[model samples]
Target: MKITVLGVGGMGSRFALMLHQGGNDVTLVDGWQANIDAIRKDGIQANFNGKPVSAKMPIYSPAEIDQSGVKADLIVVFLKSNQLDAMFKRVQPIIHKDTYVLCLLNGIGHEDVLSKYVAKDHLLLGITMWTAGMTGPGHVELSGDGEVELENFEPAGEAFAKQVVSVFEGAGLNPKYSHDVKYSIWRKACVNGTLNCLCALLDCNIGEFGKTKQAPELLHTIIDEFAAVADKEGVNLDTEEVYNHVAATFTSDIAGHYPSMHQDLVQNHRLTEIEFIDGAVARKGEQYGIATPYCKLLTQMVHVKEQLVGAK
Candidate 1:
């Protein structure tokens, strides 16, 4: 299989190296000059599965992807939610009629954006429990065990979904096909809405946040809001199940790891995907005549912090 991974930061690079070493042709696409130079010169210096390892493969920027005229059977998107529109536009040269597009991006409402770029049968919706973090240029620290749940966003697209599954399995990526992936996506979004934002605001990881007496209390407010909005959007999320899932992450192997939003705004001083997570829930609440004060306020606070530091 020939694959092009968009947004080759942490998750993208990790998957690219895995797939390439799995005997598939994989190309990494990123906007970072230092990361591109490092991989092209040395290799992808990744701590895959908690062991120090390295893998070499092609790395290119978006412009170079266009100039090189490369194409792919699969295009996996792992971009920051805010960068979806612009990043998709830049990677136009990779999409073809039969190309399958999968969005393993965090949060909700991303299918609307991806639908504009790919046809129904060629579209896939999925979420990863995997964790990866960028340590530096061409280097990532990937640890622990994670599984990917994927489903065809379009009906009758099962065959194509299986094809993508085979590729992931070949790379030792535990892949499962889900019939109710929307529920899964929303469940994951709820996890992010609770963990990512609060962790960012409190400057802590899952373990640190879990240690607080108010952690579950704070989670209830956000998850209640997310549950209401998700219900209005035709996905009924069980509050108890969702809460348990998010709470479980606190004791998981990656509990010490910083959530991505913290990695963006707090550590790197970069922009966050607040709008895509809690903010998206807030928007849906307004549309459906539901109040989402918790999400609204949290979203606003993240933005205010971003402005205070002039985070991009």
Candidate 2:
């Protein structure tokens, strides 16, 4: 399989290396010149399951992709939500009619932008439980295991979606063709909405947040806001069930882990996807006339933190 990965951060680099090692032709594209130059000079460095593994592959900036006229069988997007529109437009030359685009990004409203780039039948929406982090340019920390649940945007894309799933399976990415990926996406959003945001604000890990006395109440209120917004979007999120799923992460293997948002906003001093995650819910709540005070406040607080940290 030919694959092009957008945004070679921790998750993007992890997927690229895995696919490359899995015997697929993988090329990387990112907006970060430092990352591209680092990989170009030293290849990708990873600590996989506490063991070192490294691989070098073709890397390109978005402008380079525009000039190279590179095309792929699959375009795997793992970019930050804020970079989606500009990146997608920049990479348009690679997106041919039959080229499938699989977006495993965290949050909602991605399909709106993606649909403008590809046919509905060629768009595959997905969510992953996998976790990864970048220690530096061209360096990543990949540990633990996670599953991917994805579905085609249109019924006509089923066969190709399964083929893509098979490719993921071969690459050691646990893939499941979900009958209701929207529910899964919403469930994952609930996880990010509570744990990811709170962890960043509180300056703690999942377990640390979970150990707090206010954890349960905070989780309930935020998830209820998300469920109300999701209901308006036609995704029926069971509040208790979704809350349990997210709360389970507190005691799970990644108990000490900070979420991607924290890695971006707090550690890296970079902008986060809060606008797409919690902020998206808040915006939609306004649209649907649903009160989402928790989400609204969290989104505002994340931005305030962004300002304090001088995040771009």
Candidate 3:
């Protein structure tokens, strides 16, 4: 399959490498010039399962492809939410009628924004529990063993969803077709609501946070509030069960890893997804007449930190 991976950051780079290794023709795209230059000079480096390896693939900046017309069967977007608008604008020339666009970003509201730009038939919603990060320029580290779930939007169906899953699964990544990707996204968001923000606020790794005396209680509050909001939105999720499932993963397999929110704060980059995760809960709480004091407070604190750091 001809695939183009847009936003070749941590997860994007890892996906690019996996696809290439599986013998798919893959092209990597990112906005950063240094990372692009590094990948062009040396191969894309991925540290998976504690081993370092490189995948040789063509890397391009958006500018390089702007003048040359190019398209792909599939374009997998791994950008942060803030970058979506610019990515969609730049990829306009290459998006064809049949080009399938799959977004694997965190948080909600992505599908709404994407629908404005692309046809519903061409859009695929997806979520991943796999944890990865960019260790340095041109280097990506893979940390977790969760699968990827994807489903077609209103105009697409199960067959289209299966094709997308098959491509990723063939590349050795666990991929599943979901009839209800909305619930999958919410489930993943529930996990992130507890782990990501808490880890960022406490300045600790997943295991350290789990072991902290206040960790479990704080996590429970966040999960319970989020579950209430999810219920209000008609997405039924068992808060306690999800909490246990996430806690087990954090304590065992992903003990040493820092959540992406923590990494963003440490790097002094702007953290906007907090608005979607905790802020989303807080918003829903207001509508449903539920008080989300904790979520609202954390949302404010993270915003203040972002302003202090001058992140956009």
Candidate 4:
């Protein structure tokens, strides 16, 4: 299989390495100039599973992708939710008639943007439990085990989706073809809306926040709001189940880790996907005449933090 991985940051680089090791022809596309130059000079420098590993493969910027004449059978996207539209437009030349574009981005409503770029049969959306960390350009740390649950955007596209699942399986990606992936995406959103947002706000890691006496109350408040909004969006989320799923992550193997939002807004001083996560829920809540005080306040707080840090 020939694959192109967009946004070759922490998680993106991890997936590219795994698929390459699985014997697929994998190329990378990223917007960061430093990352592109570093990988072009030294391949990918990875501390994978606590071992130093290096692999050489082609890497390109989004602009370089078209001129390089790369035609990909599969394009697995791992960009931040905000970067989706522009990146897709830049990579238009590589998207053939039958190419499968799988979105493993976080939060909700990505399919809305993706549908504008590709046909429904060629689109797949999912959530991944995979975690990764970037130390520098072209360097990443990958650890632990994660699974990906994805489904075709259209019911008639299942056959191709199964083929993509097989390819992911060969890469040890632990792929599951889901009939109800919307529920899964919303469940994962609950995890991010609470853990990611609160951790970034409190300036703490997952376990540290979990140890606080108010953790459960905070989790319920945010998750109940998410459940209300998700219901309005035609996805019925089990509030208890979603709460437990998120609570478990506080003690999971990655408990000490700061989530991606923290890495962005707090440490790196960058813009976050707040609008896609809790902010998305808050908007839906307003549309449905439902109250989402927690989400609304959290969304505002994250933006304030962004402004304070002068985040781009």
Find the candidate with the highest lDDT and give its number: 2
- Per lDDT, what order, best first? 2, 4, 1, 3
Query: What are the TM-scores, per candidate, against the unseen true structure?
Result: 0.97, 0.98, 0.94, 0.98
Show model 3 residue runs off by greater than 4 Å.
268-270
Residue-level lDDT of model 2, residues 112-195, one tens digit each, is: 999989999999999999989899999999998988889999999999999989988988999999999999898899999999
Q: What ranges in model 4 sit over 4 Å off?
A: none
lDDT of 1 by residue, 123-156 (tens): 9999999888888889898888889999998886
Candidate 2, run of 10 with poorest lDDT? 62-71
Better of 1 and 3 by lDDT: 1
Model 4 CA lDDT for position 90: 95
Model 4 lDDT per residue over 1-312, tens place: 999999898899989999999999998999999999999999999998899998989999888877988999989999999999999999999988878899988899998999998998889999899898888888988888999999998987899899888988999999999999999999999989999999999999999999999999999999899988888778898899888888898789989888999988887788999999999999989999999999999999999999999998
- How high a TM-score does candidate 4 get? 0.98
Residue 231 of model 1 has an lDDT of: 84
Q: Looking at candidate 2, what is the lDDT of residue 102? A: 95
Local accuracy by lDDT, each model: 0.89, 0.92, 0.81, 0.91
In candidate 4, list every pair of residues with a backbone clash.
none
